[model samples]
Target: MATAAKKESKPNAGFMKPVTPSKILAEVVGTEPMPRTEVTKKVWDYIKKHDLQDAANRRMINADAKLEAVFDGKKQVSMFEMTKLISNHLKA
Candidate 1:
């Protein structure tokens, strides 16, 4: 008789604690209280809709009125920088 060997299993993703949704931030731009994920989605939506993304400078996100408020009066922010700036508006 041959003995069988056990295979190691990968850890489950759900074991990690879920992130709590922070309180929504307000901007002159919209009334929706979107979570960070949703907010990011919406920002992309707006960017595409407005054709704000520069073809030459893909990293820069140009702000409309709503985005300006969320971005702390910045007319533009880098893609990576936007995430950090948005986090500031979320309540602890």
Candidate 2:
């Protein structure tokens, strides 16, 4: 019998900063230090609350003023792309 290779888990970068208000994002949606995952979730909540998701294509999020700053001034981005944008706010 052949042994299966061990799976390596992606390490958590570090303890995620607690979600709080941020400066650049202050006007966008109130800046804060949240785990990368939580930040996205919160952004999605804002999107859903404001109906920012595209009706024709749900993957794209229409950036609001707050999101625009976080997204590097991007007006729109896919769900996958959102991750990269959110990462910029995360601090060590």
Candidate 3:
């Protein structure tokens, strides 16, 4: 049997760099600057904690008052669209 070399990987610098969240986004994710990855995690945490996902369609996230502001008044958004919307609120 032959042994194979293992590959090592590092996190992407762009994703690791800290970003400031917009005032609307701050309500859910906090006011502190955080990496994009952490912002996403915190947003998801808020969603899950608030039971914001649609019952029929788990892919859809129902926006609460705070999230609605971040979502630009959208009452609901798909999980895929959620990321795009969130990116708009992040400042480098």
The number of residue pairs in model 1 that clash at the backbone is: 0
Assess candidate 1 and give its lDDT.
0.65
RMSD of each: 6.4, 4.7, 1.8
What range of 10 consecutive residues in model 2 has the weakest lDDT sum? Answer: 25-34
| lDDT per model vs. reference | 0.65, 0.73, 0.95
Q: Over the stretch 15-84, how does candidate 3's per-residue lDDT look in tens digits?
A: 9999999988998999999999999999999999999999999999999999999888999999999999
Best by lDDT: 3
Q: What would you estimate as the lDDT of candidate 3?
A: 0.95
Flag clash pairs in model 2.
20-32, 20-33, 21-31, 21-32, 22-31, 22-32, 28-66
Better of 2 and 3 by lDDT: 3
TM-score for each candidate, following the candidate numbering? 0.60, 0.67, 0.93
Q: Which candidate do you rate higher for lDDT, 1 or 2?
A: 2
**Cα lDDT for residue 10, candidate 2:** 79
Question: For this target, which candidate reaches the highest TM-score against the unseen true structure?
Answer: 3
Stretches of candidate 2 off by over 4 Å are 1-22, 26-32
